[model samples]
Target: MSVLIENMTIKRGMKKIIDNLDLSIMDGEVVALVAPNGTGKTTLLNGIAQLLPSTYKKLEINGFEPQLLNFKRSFFYLESSSNLFEYLNIKEHLLLIKKNWQSEIVLDEVFRLLKIYEYQTLPIRKMSLGMKQHALLATYLISDAPVLLFDEPLNGLDPGSIEITNGIIQNLADKNKSILFSSHDIANIQAICNRVVFLKDGKIERDTKNMDEILELYKQLYGG
Candidate 1:
């Protein structure tokens, strides 16, 4: 399975945020989208997910156009915000995904893995930011979709949770799931991702599997 985007352009009114961008992620590949803030990393993800209004020459997921309902079923996007129902409890949220996505994932295991089991009955509004992030991640884990798009997934996570999250991502890739995530954390990116796609000036500035060189390039690009 693979996601392919060709000749894509994203604009905000008169400003072009992503211009003629082309990229692909194959099965079992974990790609990190790295860029400084406000460089359209989020916009590029949204554009690929077809969540934003944009012009594209071609956009396909597993050989299906995104307009198809099956295409929608093929991928899950973990939004930056938790975006959970404030009144719903953690279990209810998991049940919602199970019902909607027809996922067979065991809620108990997911809750345990994310350390949200104790808060299963607690409403999202009562959870801390880190807890909410766990809930968001749990949803992605249970989705069982072929392509997973995540935006700054490590934000708000503690060091321990970040390690666990990295493990989860690696496991998913080992299962042949194509994952693309955006993050500003260079260390985490080097630790988890097999490929890095660097964005700048509305285009992919660099895409490489050479992690060491990419790290050096990142430091040079951002003056770290």
Candidate 2:
């Protein structure tokens, strides 16, 4: 397993968002955290990223704990485009990640892959929402981490960009990247994810490979 968390619980003040969750993700597998807002989707991602205080009887990334440098270097999680530096441009941001992660993926290749070549010089503050979203993905590609955590990877994207994002994610999975992403776009998730897991009572209520099941559950939960 690329990700393993057992008996995990996350609390915000007095409230437990995720309680005693036991989830494991395998390499080359794409899992969807399918749930409505405030259901610990982001909270789970945050806990895995160590951005929040989560207690786990066992929390590990390929045997390395989150506090370990090796574990930290193995995953890329960009919560949102808002985390982009307003002053830094795409090239600068990607360069920073590449250096930190020591990735071999060339900068120019990433530019062409994401078609972000022109945006390289433009500061993030000047970019549109869609452009910034691409910039965020650029960082993930540059990091070349084994585990990719995406929070709404398709947000603020045009149809064309959305297609590109989906293709890129699929290609990454083909290369054996363990991916976990959260999105309410049921149709989109049905397109790319290998499995869908939903939360109920702070635990995974369902982990199904059936896309039809996901659609049916989506309607029941979200009234689509």
What C-alpha lDDT do the candidate models reach, one value each?
0.87, 0.89
| Cα-based TM-score, every candidate | 0.95, 0.96
- What's the true lDDT of residue 125 in model 1? 90
TM-score of 2: 0.96
**Any idea what lDDT model 2 has?**
0.89
Name the candidate that leads on TM-score. Answer: 2
**How much is 213 displaced in model 2, in angstroms?**
1.2
List pairs with backbone clashes in candidate 1: none
Clashing pairs counted in every model: 0, 0
lDDT tens per residue, model 1, 1-224: 58999889999999999999999889999999988888899999898888899998999987789778788778888575457888998788888888777788898889878887788898889889898888889889888888899999988999999999999999999999999999878778888888999888888888899877877888877677
Candidate 2: residue pairs that collide: none
For model 1, give the RMSD to the true fold: 1.3
